[model samples]
Target: MTREINPFGLRMPPELRELLKREARLNGRSLNAELVARLRTGSDPPDANDPPPRGMRLRTTAVQPRNGWVPTDAERAMLTVFRKLPPEKQLALLTLFE
Candidate 1:
């Protein structure tokens, strides 16, 4: 069975947000995932030498079939958020991601 987590609103300094974003990128995680992990671990992030847990994003090669990959629950939630964006905002986000 799927566990439901309630959505939360967070307000933080822009610098802290950027720091988390950078850490998320380095750790191959979404920002929310990184934050949750940090919170659960009492602020110490996982060691950089450790292997990323399963379902963590990995860089793909030409031999991999990207389209055949399944989306993670976090990705699905983000997609839902994306879908709710205004058309121009959606396009802008698409451009940003691309």
Candidate 2:
């Protein structure tokens, strides 16, 4: 049986919303369906049977610095926020920094 979906209002920047709309159109999905699909996949663990995409590999553990350096308060706070993001968004941010 399928669970019922409750409607909720969300506010986002206009540019972000437009980006989502464009993605939805490109993917042949409605805006609502695109958002729902993204939300569902955001929290789902990767399937073991699926191979990693080219240029990307999944790591079982996070890498540590050679010197075991400590993070500042601001860096720690940023890390906390980063950890709360969805995996795709995290990857996007990391790619941006790279």
Query: How much is the lDDT of residue 78 in candidate 1?
Result: 84
Q: Write the per-residue lDDT of candidate 2 for residues 1-98, one digit (tens) a residue.
A: 12576677999999989878866765568888888777776567765444333123343454454567656999768867876776567666766876
User: What C-alpha lDDT values do all the predictions have?
Assistant: 0.61, 0.64
Off by over 4 Å in 1: 1-3, 43-98
- For model 2, the superposed segments whose C-alpha errors exceed 4 Å read 1-4, 48-98
What shift in Å separates residue 21 of candidate 1 from its native position after superposition? Answer: 0.3
Name the TM-score of candidate 1.
Answer: 0.41
Model 2 — which ten-residue stretch has the worst lDDT?
A: 51-60
Quote the RMSD, in angstroms, for model 1. 13.7
Candidate No. with top TM-score: 2
